[model samples]
Target chain A: MPTIRDIARLAGVSVATVSRIINHSGKVRPETEKKVKQIIQETHYQPNQVARTLYQKRSKMIGIVVPNLNNTFYAQVIDGIQSVLQKNNYSALISFSTSSDGSKYLEAIDNFKNNNVDGIITSAFTPPANWNPTTPLVMYDSADIQDKIVRISSDNSKGGQESVKLIAKNVKKVLVQHWPLSLPTIRERVEAILKELNRQNIAYVLEEVSESDPYLAAQQALNKRNTFDAIITVNDPYAAEIIKEAKRRGVNIPKDFQLVGYDNNILCEYTDPTLSTIDQQPHLIGQTAATRLFKMMAGDTSTNNDIINVIPIKRNSTY
Target chain B: MPTIRDIARLAGVSVATVSRIINHSGKVRPETEKKVKQIIQETHYQPNQVARTLYQKRSKMIGIVVPNLNNTFYAQVIDGIQSVLQKNNYSALISFSTSSDGSKYLEAIDNFKNNNVDGIITSAFTPPANWNPTTPLVMYDSADIQDKIVRISSDNSKGGQESVKLIAKNVKKVLVQHWPLSLPTIRERVEAILKELNRQNIAYVLEEVSESDPYLAAQQALNKRNTFDAIITVNDPYAAEIIKEAKRRGVNIPKDFQLVGYDNNILCEYTDPTLSTIDQQPHLIGQTAATRLFKMMAGDTSTNNDIINVIPIKRNSTY
Candidate 1:
């Protein structure tokens, strides 16, 4: 119940000094800061965050909007974002955009604006045509937006190219499973794979599957009786589903067929035959996005052309 | 940049009426509410949330603290909590307590108090001996806290009992892998399993493993050369790891050894031979905690003794 004025009076410091110590906005001597903190703790004086936010015009909070948290990739990305945010003395308000149409994303953005978050980082959701945001927006992995917004993502095209190069010589025919090509990230991966496969004169089949249940799509693909010698999946979970279903049908991995997955999540290592995967290093991607957002907030206009590189991790999945 | 006074003038309403409409705290007629919204939209008026918070003395925000989000079970629980919180018109400020010592949890609680959250929901971190909280707190999946704090958890004991019942008739010896037994939830499950196994006079071994890397623990357990006919894991990921390792060692599941996992996560169905596990229904647990928090926030003092039931799911792992 103690006010800032009371704290200042008790600590024998100016109100601005107390505010500086509380907000960590301006530099203060270590001794003075320690003493002020001690007094504040002793008094149990809770500063009103609303008033502080109004005065500083910074909430010290960031909004993170992802399509789904149930997916380990997204969860790991969030974990990376939080790691950086916590170190920088910021908190994250996370929301899910379960639909591809981006309605939930719009709602999340509106909520961020309403709460006056200092910045926002979103993954895989494009803003509507009529939507214009006043807050600084950083798009993660969906880089096809307007030039004003900052985009940080891994090199999906390069990952796709590498995946094909690693397995192209070993297989006669390959099945490339992916999500909808409407998403720019997915499109880039598919395009790169096709370009590489065509250059090699290798026969391949491309299948677009629903993001929610790639297992069912894998099932349908198997039932089609395609004579593919290998499978390339857009992500690790899809690769896992394919592996499980193939095992159910008595298909021998690395002997009868080879498989590769993207995102290089934990599932890739835990699966039998130890799945070969493209490591996007999602934690690094998240950290990069947070650092970029902070730089943008500080009025740095330097263009960031950095794309986190991907590496192909070869395990027991392919010969 | 438009002020509330300007909004009131344009909407033909008093400043207090405009405030009421903005806060959604008081009743406003349908026509007046519609007109006020129109004017507000036309002006692009962004309310100062800090000022609004000061006036209302409520932030309409909740805090959720969990140990980790990379685990799918925690992610699912958070998804459920967000579902309920969003429906109730509240935003969640989520934080993680990475360490088992409970320091991060205390910090999160302090942050929640400083931010004036209406309530808090936390999982599996005990407060320090000297710590006291003034905010309404709900402990999720950790029920061994003080008597004053409301604890909401699934019947982990019953889950352990059911897991044993499902696999008891088929196996001669069992290996139970879990995290530290000091945790209330883990203790409950282990105790229930042991009690049931003793009642049935079935021999079993208990092993505590590092949670961060259950795969390594599974490897170590397999390397110990224990001649066990079945394995009971505290969660699904560990079960998956054991299955992967067992298969690597040419150990066939349900044929060589039966397995039962807890939490019945999506991984259970995706693994080869499909893991039989206990279903804790994490979504319902989250929903129940949120409902209880809301009841407590409304000054309800009645004790809640409801325990969500756990079900045993049969799959190829347990025959």
Candidate 2:
């Protein structure tokens, strides 16, 4: 309940000194800061964030739009964002917009704008054609938008190329399973893989899989007439299901068929053959996005879009 | 930049009617409401949330304190909470405080209070002794707190008892690997297991493992003794590691040693033998907590603390 004036009076310092200490803007003597802090703590003085936001037109809050929290990848990315946001004395308002219809995504954006967030970080949701937002928007993994919006993503194309190069060594025929290519990020990886395979003249079969029911997709892929000496999956979960189903059908990994997956999730290390995967470094992607958003908010216009490189982790799944 | 007065004047209504319609507080004529809404949309009217918060002393924001985001259980719970919060037009401010020392927990509490969150839902972190918060506090998976604090937890004791009873059916000598029982939830499970084991007169040995490194604990547990016919793990990740390590050592599960794990995560089905675990229903826990918090905020004093039921999932490891 104690205001800045009360803290100043109690600490025997000017109100300007109190404001400086609270905002860390203007310079104040170390002794004066210490005294003001002690008084503020003793009196349990909480700065009125509502009033401050009204006066400065800044909420010190950032909005994060994640597709799904059940995915460890997104959760870890959020963790990375929070780590940076906490250090900078900012709060993150998280909203889950899992629908690809763009309605929920637009609603979340509108809600953030209504709350007057300083910035927004969204993962893998393309805006509608008629939508336009004035807020500083940072897209994470949802690329190919307008040039004005800042985009941050892992180098999925490179990851795809490296995966093909790795699998091309031992197998003549490879099965590549992917989700819908409607997502620009997934399309980038798919195109890169196809280009590399064509350049290498490797024989490969591409199959589309449902992201929701990857296990069924794996089963359907296996039931197809074409036999593959090796398999590459869009993500770890699909690869895991393939490995399990393949084992059920008496096919051995590495000996009969090699396997590779993207998104080096923890399951990659625990799978039967210990999956080989491309590590996209989701945490790093999140941290980079937050850092770039902060820089942009701080009037650093030179902060350009970034693409984090992915690393190929080889385990027993592949030679 | 259109104010409430502008929208009201354009719609031929008073400012108070616009405010009531916006806040959904008081009754307004249907025709007037529709006209005001149309004009507000046309003019792109966004109410100043900061000003409204200052005036009404309510932000319609709830804070969630999670210890770790990498864990899928917590992520699923958060998803459930967000689903409800979004439906109610409330925002979730999430904070991660991984330390058990309680400093980060207290800091998150302080930050949430400063931001004027209507309530807080924390996952398994005990509040500092000297701390007293008047805001509605909900403890998720943390029981035995103050009388006023609402606690929402799965019936860990029941889950533990069921696990022990199941394992005792096939094996006499059992090994139980758990995290530090210092956590109230873990303690409940451990105590229940021990009590049941005693009642059945089944010999058992208990070992504490690091939650961060379950694989090492599994290896150490395996190295410590090689005679147990059954093993009970604290969670799925530890069970997955134990299964993988046991396979490495040429130990067959179910044929040689039965295994049971807690928190039936998604990885449970992907494990080689497929893990048998206690399903804590994290989604229901989250939903229940949010529902109770909303009720409490609505001045429902009779909202009692709840204990969600846990079910034992039968899988290859146990059967």
Candidate 3:
């Protein structure tokens, strides 16, 4: 096994230059980098990451916490994060919370701290009363209410307004299907929807639904089909279920009622009538969060919240 | 911060016992383990994982390389891997190989080796001529042809037979829609399908399609709707796209032609006529691969190829 010193001697470069090239930290000329990399490849010189971490006090690992992988949304977010991590030559230690609880987030953070990770990026979770920020942390899919923590959030207010505009054109009474409003992200969107509805003088009613069973939620939402002229679903999957259920119930989508959904999921384009939804660009959100975390890890102590804009996709489901 | 020695002293246990508890190695009484954990938590004793890795020559990390996260199949597999790792106190270092090239896989393996991962689990890829097995590796979604490497493969041969059976009941001519058959896994399934087709005296024509654009593939396949009585798609998403295209051309599924697909994806139920496909149970495959890797890491060097069974899902797309 060739050591870093051997690589430096072979390439006629200083050890610090080789270290910069290996860590992807400092700038190196393209020709020098290419020449050194070719030699490293030829020699098969493997860097001992464990010893390097011990000496530098940086693990070059980022801890990431996602809610779950079942939803393509989170998967896209992880993909985006990976895009950045790979570019920076950093590895990710990921934990799937699987449930909406703060305990798992805390445990993951503690584990990352024990590993001496460079930084942490996690999804939305309420911090405990005794919360302390000892490491650079970035939160996404959050409401951006923490006093000292940086956050990356989707522009839910704009999405909510877009949803109303999509359906309110030909709607009278609209039924809004939703999950728990205790979630600050959901509340932000719902509040924006209500304000827009009031501004447009559209009569609307909020219907709480079960997130676990979108099919059953669709059935319940459709049971009031005769009363409402339009329906706004919790998300794309729920909207897809509503379309399936409507087809079975002999209900025409845009004729009987209009429909709109959040999270422009991939299923949107495949549905029979094609769904109208909000494009949150979850991939961009993940990339932004990771980029910000790296900036903070580089000694930028500024705490701020960033918002990625949303786009409204109109399709056959809307009039 | 409290040290491990302090925790062991307070719990009236030896340093080795405390070390075993922290590393999740060896055996300890339930009460003693609980008492020690409680004290450690209360005292905020964070284990130094970097130092531990230096001393133990084990990182307690697993490197995972998947093709991509765009498909829900890979996501489900990662979820399953996480389930096993969470219980055993292991963290996953994941790299998403977005492209089909073998170079990304090689790079990932080199990085994982540099980081000293305890083991590795990767999707199908061709190894170089001078490949050496210096680390424990388990391959999934691959042909079990590697000499010393353990592989977990879905019973693709059985899946192919099931696909033939699903559409063979009332079919004369079949259009087999597929991507590049150069891939070993796809070739395995195609061989079985051809065998089953010959056994049933069914006439079949292989139609190569573009995986990057499924909608266009649907259009191309539908152009031959008059010549074939059934179409077997590469996967569920492609099947769903065929359904959408057929609806546009006023071709009723199971009427104009029967359809069967591979991978009973989430789109199966949401498709208009539903998709009759093969269930690969990717989650179970992931769990099995991780479990086998752990066994190998425990000094069980027996190499055996495991095949997880596939199921034929009966849905409305077939007669």
Chain A superposition TM-score per model? 0.89, 0.89, 0.88
Where does candidate 3 chain B have its weakest 10-residue lDDT segment? B142-151
Clashing pairs in 3: none
Tens digit of per-residue lDDT, candidate 1, span B27-75: 9999999999999999999886556777788777888998888777788
In candidate 2, clashing pairs total 0
Query: Which parts of model 3 have CA positions greater than 4 angstroms off?
Result: A1-44, B1-43
- The collision pairs in model 2 are none
Q: How much lDDT does each candidate structure score?
A: 0.82, 0.84, 0.89
Best candidate according to lDDT:
3
lDDT of 1 at A310: 89
Candidate 2 C-alpha lDDT tens digits along B1-319: 8887788888888888888888888899898889888998899898877666765678989999987788899998888888789889899988887787677887888888877889888886666565566777777876545465688978888999999866776677899988888788889889999999998999999988887888798898668546788999889888898898888888888888899988889888788898888999999989988988898788776635798999999888985
Leading candidate by TM-score: 2
lDDT of 3 at A258: 94
Q: Which prediction has the highest DockQ against the true structure?
A: 2
**TM-score between candidate 3 and the true structure:** 0.91
Separately for all candidates shown, the number of backbone clashes (residues 3 or more apart, or on different chains) is: 0, 0, 0
Model 2: residues with Cα > 4 Å off, grouped in runs: A4-21, A25-42, A128-132, A144-146, B5-17, B26-39, B129-131, B144-146
RMSD list, candidates in order: 2.9, 2.8, 4.1
> Which scores better on DockQ, 1 or 3?
3
